[model samples]
Target: MKRILIILVLVLICTQIKAQRPMDWAFKLNLKDYNVKYSLPKGFSHLDSMISSYCRSDWSELFQYSLINTEGDIAIRFLMIPITPKTAEQLEYRKRLFNLSELFPPNQNYLRTIYFQLEADTTNRIAYYPKAYAKKTFNVDVAGEYDRECKIVYKGKFYKSKVVFLHKEDRMDCFIHYFYEEGKEEKVRETIAKTRGMFRLR
Candidate 1:
């Protein structure tokens, strides 16, 4: 009986180890009175704010935290910015699809804020793989749900990206991941999920 119990314990331990297959590193960011926490896959680390400029562009300027994969040049950048008026108008127009007010006054800002992030990030990433120019594919998900993917090919390798947009009462949260090498889609998804899981209002 004691031998059986010992064997059971060993099995449980092995299972636990297998379940946590991908290791992760965590970090937090404070921006405009909001606290954001997220994790990177084991080989990535947060880059200093001063050196984070490389990830920014005129359209996507509000950077929260930037991370680089230690094993390679892969990177993930987080951004948050206020919604613009034009964006609000588009959202208000879309709301009409559900018989909501074409004026959707209250949600116009909300929708535009999220839309701008999606648009800016998607465009900026395209420039990085200009040579390959593969097909650009993405989906406009429901306000609270996410399921978007973008692909870029650099040199002879393929890079996969997942961009997420979240609209808060005050601002929009944007998350982007670039798997610099080919075949890291699962890892990229896992890292993005871990980061989103740590998001907090305060």
Candidate 2:
């Protein structure tokens, strides 16, 4: 009887660990002849209405994917812009300019010029990181490819963003991880970490 009870407890603990492990999904971001593969966390569903509402022509050109949680709040956004058909000199120029600093809009009027134009306003107040938080920077490694990262606060919520230019693919991919009303920062962090670990640029 004692041995059976020990085995049952061990099995229960193992099951809980497996349940907490992050799950991954692989997909493609394609534009004409350009295509890249990435592995990201699951449980997010596509928010089709965002494409029709928030997205405009210029925005649509670069917006590859928009996803949201059950509450209808966007949790992840994947943006890509192709830089092919350019001369070798142009590629080098863009690569130099494409970094974490360039990912965000100008701080002077970030909301009015960029966020408002793209996402607009939906009862959400715009809040930029103060000078201290603005200096916070991090890094992301996706299947060995590295990128500079930063955090931004929107509507009193936190988000992490990564921007990188793929030299081989000649494209720029911007990844934004949004923390919505879930109120679970640890879960969001784990998801971001897991997805970043599994990302593969093809």
Candidate 3:
């Protein structure tokens, strides 16, 4: 009877170990060259995969993965582009051009308004770990928008959107586009902060 009780206790311990396993992520990617892995945030669910198939645009080629909250009010769209030597050179040239443009107020304003529709409160060059080459978070005023699936859910209501860009030289160039309503900036900021922990490199 003592031996039988020991086996029962061992089985119970094994069952508890399995129950404590980590939560499964909805999306995961392994970049062999970089020796890094990427996973979607823990709380978010995978956005519909079909959305990527139908969306065709210049940036569409870069689309990789996406996630959305249960309420559907908040979403994250990820884009990744491989860095090439020629592209790196072009990026440097663009930086120089931007610097030159900043010397002229009219040119700077024009570029900002036309490209970003940026709002008054913009934060730039905030660093996050595991340390990307550059990181920028900013707000933009945009017209009514649809979700990745092109559904008319958010139509007719203007949106204040947040955009985050993270560039890791020779490894990854990624954009995380965040969509949320007006008063949820604080929540979104917290989510952005969590991204630092989500990505890691060997």
- Order of models, best lDDT first: 3, 1, 2
TM-score of each: 0.44, 0.38, 0.47
TM-score for model 1? Answer: 0.44
Local accuracy of candidate 2 as per-residue lDDT tens digits, 125-171: 33322333222221211111111222334334424333221222234
Better of 1 and 3 by TM-score: 3
**Candidate 2: where are CA atoms >4 Å away?**
1-32, 49-62, 70-74, 87-169, 197-199
Roughly what TM-score does model 2 have, to 2 decimal places?
0.38
Q: On residues 13-108, what C-alpha lDDT tens digit does candidate 3 reach at each position?
A: 997555433211223432454455566677787664334331223222433565777766677765544455565465557669767443213212
Best by TM-score: 3
Model 3 clash count equals: 0
lDDT of each: 0.46, 0.39, 0.47
Ranking the candidates on TM-score from highest down gives 3, 1, 2
User: Which segments of candidate 1 are over 4 A away from where they belong?
Assistant: 1-29, 35-43, 51-64, 82-110, 113-160, 176-180
